[model samples]
Target: MSKIVVIDPGHGGKDPGACANGLKEKDIVLKISKYAKDYLEDGYEGVKVYLTRSTDVFLELSERAKFANNKKADLFVSNHINAGGGTGFESYVYTTINGGTTEKMRSAVHNEVMTVYKGFRDRGKKKANLAVVRETAMEAMLLEHLFIDTKKDADFLKLDDNLKAIAKAEANGIAKALGLKPKTVKKEAPKKEAPKKDIPKKDGKLSKVQVGAFADPKNAEKLAAELKKKGYKPFITKE
Candidate 1:
């Protein structure tokens, strides 16, 4: 069975959410959401993913929820960056939703994202009657990646590695929860070539001079720097 996921990047365009510490929630979440979508499309099989808003355009909360409901999506993930004091990763499900797959998804995504942002506190799976979770017909959850207000969190978000890691984890969690499989990659066999005739060996004694040998490349670099100062062009090679 094919699984469908709708990724909603919260806030956009004119509505730049929580602009603090030189980071914008809307922009950061959009990058993460897009990354997740790309990962699912490229790596996961039997899965179809869609984004509510691909561009930096404002979208109504109702519209986002309705899009998933109308599409009959299997899962809905809303991405956002938090602000206003607290610092950490948090995932939320609809408060009215009892213990079920949706709740399990919340836990899965929370844990996966936390693995990458381990520095931040794990806020744990929470419950709230948010529009995206409350109105969507399918399993839905909202992810607050990190606090944009907190300087530490904001700095972390600034790193491209963290964003990519968070996106990958989110996709992986969703794929696992939905029982989706990864796309099969075929490996090509090594090509065989016929044996070649041996060539005549050169009869000459080559003379070479060694400058220095060091296990650490930094030491070799330091020697090279000294050589350059002495008006010599030094080249370093790895053995």
Candidate 2:
């Protein structure tokens, strides 16, 4: 049976989460979770991963925990960005349960991710009664990637490359803990060449990836706020 990992991106939609220095926790966590999911799917085998919420959608805390429990996930990892008076990477596991595969998994992920965040302070691994971790049946952990309130941390997270790097580290760590192997990508056989035909030249243009278009300006503004947190200068075009 494949090992099941459920990733929960903390806060979304109605919940803006912790906001500071023009950064929102909801946006950062979502981006990290999405990138992690993609990396694991494309590079690893014998693992099935699921997200509590895929997009900007509000989910109750209980609902998030229930989703993982219902799925019988082998592990639950919740992603979040911190706020208020701290700047660094910190991870949490259940307070009572210590020293086992769970702690090893937490350490594996924390070490891998913190290595990339070398300049940032190492807050160290901790234990807490966080809803998702406490409620989930499987071994669970929650990660505070960095502090949104801290200028240095927020600036680092604002870069797209940093987000991708963090995601890769976490995903790779999870794969390592699960003893996963890279999937074998099949190579296609080369085909015989055909005679060339005349083709017309086309004008070059820049392309943009859009998240959504909303009828209400409030909704549009919300998306723009989230995008801004991701270091995007998004503007809504009226039609």
Candidate 3:
């Protein structure tokens, strides 16, 4: 098995990323990264995984790449949700692999991730020297897996099963990139529906229900939890 992996969840804090139907790219990829890490670690032995940030904190793009470089990771997977009206998944590698055999790495990832979602557009191999891709030393792939602004994308991903499917596909993608035999995806315990945001009431009574446009669904859930603690019912709505 490939030795170490670094997963970077893009955008956090002030950088809310794309907004649509109350979902933010930061929160979406955070959920994916956590599950991907779990999917990989449980299914493979001697594989160490680390995330650049596990929460809604922000980091410069370059800093994220540096973390992976510092670790000398075998593979660096930068997770991001795409924007615009487009649908589908595309993987990016540096325009030049600095003479490294990284394009093959990118191809492996592209092939596996595109396997599950047939409707996804094949944005085939492209190049860019983004901070994460250029500065990283090891093989790396930045995934533009899905567009968060579109309902069709959200409808598919919001389902718990779809999220697990994505995680499995990503884990397999990395294994394939490193030219390792694919491993079985460890099954996830079924996840419940995402909790809703809360609303406050007047007249000295906390309302049993409230929902708001959160820009980020996870943020909405966090707000909901806080409201519930304050005796308000909360649910989240999209932009």
Count of steric clashes across candidates, in order: 0, 0, 14
The 0-to-1 C-alpha lDDT of every candidate, in the order given, reads 0.89, 0.90, 0.79
Spell out the clash pairs found in candidate 2. Answer: none
In terms of lDDT, which candidate is strongest? 2
Sorted by lDDT, highest first, which candidate order results?
Answer: 2, 1, 3
Instruction: For residues 132-168, write the lDDT of model 1, one tens digit per residue.
Output: 9999999999999889989899999999888988999
User: Candidate 3 lDDT, tens digit per residue, 1-239?
Assistant: 44889999899999988878778888888888888889877776667889999999999998998899898898898988888888888888887765356877777777877887778678767777788888888888899877787788877767767777887888877766665544555696546744443334566554453456666678878877887786555556654
**Per-model RMSD to reference:** 12.6, 20.8, 20.6
Weakest 10 consecutive residues, lDDT, candidate 3? Answer: 193-202
- TM-scores for all candidates? 0.77, 0.77, 0.71
Q: Which stretches of candidate 2 lie over 4 Å from their true place?
A: 185-239
Tens-place lDDT per residue, model 2, 1-239, is 89899999999999989999888899989999999999988899988899999999999999999999999998899999998879899999988976999999998899999988988999999999888999999989999999998899999999989999999999998988788898886784445633222233465444666779888989999999987776567789888
Question: Which portions of model 3 miss their true places by more than 4 Å?
Answer: 98-100, 179-239
Off by over 4 Å in 1: 188-239
